[model samples]
Target: MNIRLRSAVAGDYDAVNAIIREGQDEHAEALPDRFARLDQVVAMGWYRSFSKQPNKEIIVAECGDKLVGVAMLEMKQSPSFEALVPRTYAYLNELAVASTHQRQGIGKKLYTASLAWARERGASSLELNVWEFNERAQQFYASVGMRTLHRMLFTDLT
Candidate 1:
């Protein structure tokens, strides 16, 4: 029952990646191959680049020194499409929890920590994307006060 969460260090990349793979496997039956591969690679690369970017933060949840979850936050500027909104925003690009520890508040703790981290950095808004068919994820976000604002579609050229 003892669990802790903290910002990811360079040494935690592999653990973070492992958590991602495990979480993805839980929904592999519903995800497109291209979506799956590209997202995984992008997540790994984020960890690799974390050392160079002061604005990008990736946090890991650990239990007795073992990484069980990860959350990534990036300082972002509002897109031009939304001319009415402020420019400074926060993007939560990724958040994954190991299936073994899910629903035990590990994911919530990671999210809460990431939110505080984003706020401390002067982010005006926080945003993230979930796959359209991932109802479980959408429900989680909703329970956390996030609303469905738009629908995002994708296609594979390969």
Candidate 2:
């Protein structure tokens, strides 16, 4: 299958939202308390606002006339704290492939493109946060040469 990667256009909002919804559904199912299923409009609105940010971008993978995947990326700077070194980095906010098109290497392609994008912007590193419950996502990230930088622990109070 021939797939093309490009910066998302205004017309691609709905397709992007659909792919995002697929990922969101998995998150909601895996951790109902932390994630709630979102309406399409709500998702689209959030996407719209995110896409408008100067330091953010939504990249899409197109197969023929259809959009099959998306990656949301942002260029961010570490806060200026006395204990922390100041640096710029690329954050992978979200990466999702339509359920029908997953496992066909679309996600990997998107990841490669994301790295290139970061490098082009002179980012010191590419970073992201993946929940512990999402083992599949963690495995995928590991396969892509991403190692855990740190872990976030939490406690539940009933």
Candidate 3:
């Protein structure tokens, strides 16, 4: 199957939302307290707002006439502070491939496009956050040459 990667347009709202909702549903099921499944209206609205950010982009993977995957990216800079190094980077806010279309290299295409987009815009690095419960996602990311940067820990104070 041929997969085409391109910048998303306003007309892609529904398809993109559907793909995102799949991932959201999984997250919600795995961690009810941390993830909430969004309704279509709310998801679409949030996508609209997020896509409009000046330093953000939404990349979609299309198979023939269907949108099967999406990657949301954001350009960010490390804050100038005494304890931090200054640099610009690209953040992979979200990446989701439709349940029916996984393992066909669509995710890799989206990721390649995202990296190129960041490189073209002078970003020095690419980063993303994956929840521990999503082992599949972690494995996919690792297969693409990403490694653990840091771990976020939390305590239940109850």
Instruction: Determine which window of 10 residues in candidate 3 has minimal summed lDDT.
Output: 41-50
lDDT (tens digit, per residue) of candidate 1 on 33-152: 634533454465657776579888888888897888989888987666865665787888889898888899988888888889888989876889888778889899898888877886
For candidate 3, list the clashing residue pairs, or say none: none
What would the TM-scores of all predictions be? 0.85, 0.93, 0.93
Tens-place lDDT digits, model 2, residues 24-117: 8888999999998986823667677666886788889999999999999999999999999999999998899999998999999999999999
Measured with C-alpha atoms, the lDDT of residue 130 in candidate 3 is: 96
Prediction 3 global C-alpha lDDT: 0.90
Model 1 lDDT vs. the true structure? 0.79
What is the clash count for each candidate, in the order shown? 0, 0, 0
How high is the CA lDDT of each candidate model? 0.79, 0.89, 0.90
CA RMSD of each candidate after superposition: 2.9, 1.5, 1.7
Error of 2 at 105 (Å): 0.8
Model 3: per-residue Cα lDDT over 97-121, one tens digit each: 9999999999999999999989998
Error of 1 at 10 (Å): 1.8
Model 3 TM-score on a 0 to 1 scale: 0.93
